[model samples]
Structures are given as C-alpha cells and as structure tokens.
Target: MSKILIVGAHGQTARIVIDRIISETDDSLVLFLRNSSRLNEYDNNSRVELIDGDVLNTDSLVSAMKNVDIVYSNVGGTDLAKQTASILEAMTKSNKKRLIFISSLGAYHEVPGKFGEWNEQAIAAYLPGFRESAKLIENSNTEYTMIRPAWMSNKDEIDYETTQKGEPFKGTEVSRKSIADFVMELLSDPTQHIDESIGLNKPNTDGDKPEWI
Candidate 1:
C-alpha cells in the first residue's frame, strides 16, 4: 500500500479525498496541517496519521515525508510560490517525488474574453503568486501537476472538464466535488499528468463570470 502525504489536510478538497481513500483504497495517509485537532475524527483510523505541522517548516515537512510515496498538497495561502519552493526542497531532501498542487485559474493568463478580464479583477492580489508557483514547479525536476480550478462551488456533483496550460480555460465554475474527484483520479495513477498544469471547470458553465457573482 502506498503511503500518501496530504499537506493542508484540513482543506475541503483534502477532506473529501481523505474520506475517499479510506473507503476505496488500501493506501495509508499522513494528514498534515497546522492544527491536527481539526481531524480528530480520524484518530481511530489505522490507515491515517494526523500531524500538526506547517508546510513552511522544512524540518517538519521532511519528517512527514518519511516513507511517503506521493504528496498531494491542497494548499491555499497568500504566498503560494514560497510554500511551493519549500515543498520542493523538502521533497529533494527526503528523496521523494510526485506532487499534486492545487492552484487557481488564470495562472498563465490562459482564460479568454470578458470572463478573463473579470477573473483577473476578482483575484488580482493572489494571481501573481500562483503564476510564480507554476514557474517554480515546472522548473523543478520533480514529478508535479498543478491543478488550476475555476470558481468553485459546494455543489455535490462531479461534472468537470480540463484544459491544458496554453489552451484558453473553459467554463466558469466547478464543484469542489469535481476537483476532489479529479484529485482522486490522479492519486489512483500518480504517473499521469506529470510536469503539466491543468485547468478544470464544469461542462456548460461557460459565462463571462460565475453565476453567483
């Protein structure tokens, strides 16, 4: 059974993935988050280990990376590039590879039309950090796939499609469930989508902006 290390395990998508892995696979999980108490629900689970740690702490990351076959990072923060850099360094020190990082749409300015303009204004502050993160991951030698998801919703459905780095992004929004489903698919075969950045959105969700806003 593969030992998977999930950084930022408290994240919504990570929580979904954790439940899925526990129910569907024999994989063991190391759930790392700053506050492990949030995941006390998994305390009795033999297949799971909850760790109270910060991704910025390379020493903590190195300790957690021990014996891990893959790393799935569902991280959200203001300094994405900095966090990504630390993760890569920790992986190298730990002699591990394979990373799945959650990014956002427009990292490469791939979105098109008025929607693109609107999106830029929506998350203008954090866009550059994501773009820099893409560069860091791509330039590194480790096997990594950056997941750039469009506006997310709490809807309990899994209907989504993907676009490559250079392709104009499709649709307007995708459910967190859809993103979680895609992440689980990647975990099933970590060999796929290596060193690539993918964009996700729900089918038929094309719009100048998300319907909610």
Candidate 2:
C-alpha cells in the first residue's frame, strides 16, 4: 500500500481528506501536526499514524517522511514561505518526489480587474508569504501539483470544478470538502498532475474574477 503523509492534519480540509482515505483506500497515512492533542478527535484506525511535528522543524519532518510515497500539504499561515522552505528541504533530503500542495488563488500577482483587487485586499495581510512559498515550489525539482482554491468555506458538500494552468478559474468560494476531494483524487493517481498548478472553484458562480488571472 502507498504510504501517504499529510501536513496540517488538524485542518478542516485535511480532516476531509483523512476521512475519505480511511473510507476509500487501504493506503497508510501519517499525519503531521504541531499539536498531538487534537488527534483524539479522530477515530482510531490502524491505517492512521499521527506524528507531532511542525513544518518548520526540518529534522522532525524529515524523519516522518521516511518510506513515505506521497506528501500532501495543507499548511497555511503568515509564515508560509519559511514553512514551505522547511518542507521542501525535508522532502529533498528524503528523496521524496511526489508532492501535492495547497496554495491560494492570490499567488498569481498579475490577474487584473476588481477580482484581483478583492484578492489583493483579502490576502494583503499574508500575500508576501503566499507569493514566496509558491515561487519556491514552482522552482523546485520535485514532482508537484499546486492547487489554488478560491475562498474556502467549511461546507459539507464536495462539488467543484478545476481549471489547469492555462484556464482562468477564480471568483466564487469553494468548500473545504471539495478541496479535500481534489487532494484525494490526486492521491489516487499522483502523476496525472506532476509539475503543474491548478485553480478550483464552485461551478456556475459568477463574481469578481480571480486576481491570479
């Protein structure tokens, strides 16, 4: 069975992915999180292993990556650049090539119009971190798929559409469950999205265009 490691295990999106994996796949999962206390909320399962490690702690992260086939990261914060740097360093040192990263729609600095303005205003507090982290992943040698989702809601539904690098997909918010579904889909066939980035959004929703046009 494939060994998968998920960073930010306590996040809502992460939890959705975890539940999907537990119910649909036999692959083993290693959950990396800063806090071990929250793990108890999840049902005990033999397929799950919880590791207490912050993404910023390179040593711990590297150790946890041992024998891991895939790394799915849902980490987010104002210090995203540093955290992503640490994850990259750890994955490189471990010789792990598969990565599925969750980024924000604002990472593309050139999308024009009011939607861009809205994105800028929404992420202005953390734009630097998002931009730099995305650049690091883009330039890295690892096989990676960076998924940028529009505004996220904690809704239970898992309906959404994805747009590849060439398409424009931004505007309405998508549910965290949908993002989790996308990650699970990628995990089922990791190579399908290698060396690519994509945007996700709810269907038929119209609003300000994405800033990352």
Q: Number of the top candidate by lDDT? A: 1
Candidate 1 lDDT, 83-191, residue by residue in tens: 8888999999999889999999999999999999999999998998898988998988789989999999999999999999889999999999999999999999988
lDDT of 2: 0.85
Error of 2 at 166 (Å): 4.7
Candidates in order, TM-scores: namely 0.98, 0.92
Off by over 4 Å in 2: 41-43, 110-112, 209-213
Give candidate 1 regions above 4 Å deviation: none
The numbered model that scores best in TM-score is: 1
lDDT of each candidate versus the true structure: 0.93, 0.85
- Report the lDDT tens digits of candidate 2 across residue range 74-166: 899899999999999999999999999999876876434677677788789788888898899989988999998888887779889877775
Cα lDDT for residue 174, candidate 1:
97
What is the lDDT, from 0 to 100, of the residue 24 in candidate 2?
Answer: 93
lDDT of 1: 0.93
